[model samples]
Target: MRAILAPLWNNAYLLMTLTCLFWAGNSVIGRAARDLVPPVGLAFWRWVLAFTLLIGVAWPYLKRDREILLKQWRWVVALGALGVGAFNTLLYSGLQYTTAINALLMQSAQPPLIMLMAFFLFRDRTGPVQIVGVLLSLVGVLVIVAGGDIDVLIHLRLNPGDAIILGAMLLWVLYSVLLRFRPPVHPLSFLAATFGIAILFITPFYVMELMAGRRIVPVAESFATIAYVGIFPSLLAYAFFNRGVELLGPGRAGVFLNLMPVFGSLLAIALLGERFTTAHAVGIGLIGIGLLLTRKA
Candidate 1:
């Protein structure tokens, strides 16, 4: 088994797959516990915990890279704000009002959004195959959103949650595009810096959440949710995703995100007792094919 898995162990795609799986879990947890913890509080405490865990691990590198980090502070702050602060807070907020299925479908729009942003901002060229892959993956998401009925979309339904999630997706796309400017620092240091800035940026909003009388109920489940998101998604998933983006570049890395809904659906079946339907199978198939096409070109 070790021999068989050896080659795949170091594969960037596998790392990205793990990242998406953890993130899918994050979404599920966020949605499941939406009533237990307010979104801003959840988002705030998640990074607070992640930052606490990361700082010690990253301190040595951070000390060594202090000058470079200071020199590039603005870029780091932007990364933290968009990728960490806004993206997650918005996502959690959206989950309060939307189904996970709807949110993940909105998120599937990230690839093409990233592609278009790259083209305009960086003059990065996407090949025809990549475009086709993106479209196919998008179609798969549409299938989920429309509940396998094309006519459902004709009603042009609009909801606050969908809009919020779409906005979150836009923040993530911008964050992914901005990753090209990441300074050459240790991943730990980078994560530490971003987590710190993200926490700082979200502090006001978190205060407002408290001021508005929305507080996190200190329950075992709430703490469990925060702890899981802190360790897995915030720390490990970000580490894995950063490595994947470094190895494969953001565009290719974005392709693996198509797996999120697949993982989300499976998780729903296992945890929430949601039915596994034909639409899910077909959507998963299309996403798999789309990933393969992404690999082709």
Candidate 2:
């Protein structure tokens, strides 16, 4: 399969899809384990877990290619900050006050932000179709976020968590764009470094939260879910996303942002027993159309 799909296989699609699914599960898990993980502490511990895994798996690479990574340590650390640190921080923080609806809906905005950022930062081109696609996906996101009523937004009832999620959305776009200029480190080593450094940077928060009597415990069916988040979403998700951009270019992979809401909404209902609603379907369709419009030619 690897040999046959080399020309057409989309690591980006797989990465984006897995990310959406993992994130969807996280949403459900967040609601269930809200008390256990807390907000900032949860984000802090995810990096702690991811950091330990990366160090164990890629420590050799770090030692072997120390010089190469050192040559670009600045960018690597910066990427780690935005990609792993700020984004996850914003996500977990937002999850504290927001519903899964806001979390997923805000994430849907990443494509346009990435596209527009890439165009401005790197002089990439954007066409009419891209605009339409962005607008379309946006409608679905808004519908979903507003719970399909639109009136909710008008009533000024949006939660603070929603804004935090939006911050996370922007962080992802910034991270995606940065992937285009990634250092010359192996993917594993890069992920390890990114997660590791992010953990280092975020440890104080974790300790502070811990000192405040916050403890990490399981909210999912098993403690293994935390392990899964570390292995798959944190490690594998980062690897595939980076690989996708490396192989397909960031411009093309940005379209995958649209799929998040589709998968997130479904998983939320299944894993978390979240109620399905007509508004969700409408939002999904609109986001679908918008995402299609943004696909690369």
Candidate 3:
């Protein structure tokens, strides 16, 4: 198993692709389970379970990197608060009132936001080709989001849920930009620290949720949702995404986020029995072209 997985670990594109895939599934599951689980509670338990699962493997690294983690405590805490704690909580909460289509469309804004934030924060510059690629991919996303009808966008209305999702997206951009300052430690150590800290950051909100009587439903589907989220999106996706950013830098790594809506559309078709349409094919093609152009640039 180690031999098979070892080679893939060094492949940044593969790692980012898998990260988006897991995250896309997370959105679908979060939306589906909104009524079954409270948003804050889901975020809290997801990180708690992730920390529990990872700490065993990360213990040695955590001990070895204790001093470095301490010196970089601010970065760790900020990342935990924004990325793991706030982002998922806001996303799930938004999904409760917004359509998945709106959420995915809003999510498509991350790549450019990441690039812009990177530039302002670190003087990271993007080439003209890269900018074009980003815009092209964005058009593709809009194609998918609008179901190939421009009127869909024109007729769209802003709701409170959309505002919440937009806030989540902005928080994620800040997190991605800050990843450049991550502590120079083993990836496991960093992930474990962040996951643990995120659990702490989310505790108050989770308690408030419970106090409000918004507890998770005690059903097999709810349990399954929690388990899947804990393992895949919380544990593996963050691990993969962080490594991808380490390898590719935030700007390049951010482009992979554009793949989420593509995967989300395909997943919807497969899981929800939605029909595959011409718009899907065209949007996917444009996104592919954009990715290739960005890679070359």
Better of 1 and 2 by TM-score: 1
Error of 3 at 133 (Å): 1.3
Identify the candidate with maximal TM-score: 3
Summing lDDT over every window of 10 consecutive residues in candidate 1, give the lowest-scoring window: 2-11
**Whole-model Cα lDDT per candidate?**
0.88, 0.73, 0.92
lDDT of 2 by residue, 215-279 (tens): 76755533554666666667667777788788656766776766667777677677668899998
Q: Between 2 and 3, whose TM-score is larger? A: 3
TM-score of 2: 0.85
Q: Which of 1 and 3 is ahead in TM-score?
A: 3
Cα RMSD, each candidate: 2.5, 2.9, 0.9
lDDT of 3 at 9: 93
Where model 1 places Cα greater than 4 Å from the true spot, the runs are 1-10
Whole-structure CA lDDT of model 1: 0.88
Ordered by TM-score, highest first, the candidates read: 3, 1, 2
Q: For model 3, state the Cα shift of residue 282 in Å.
A: 0.4
Q: Which 10-residue window in model 2 sums to the lowest lDDT?
A: 218-227
lDDT tens string, model 3, 49-153?
Answer: 899999999999999999999998999999989998899999988988898778888999999999999999899989999998888899999999899999999
How well does candidate 3 match the true structure in TM-score terms? 0.98
Candidate with the greatest lDDT versus the true structure = 3
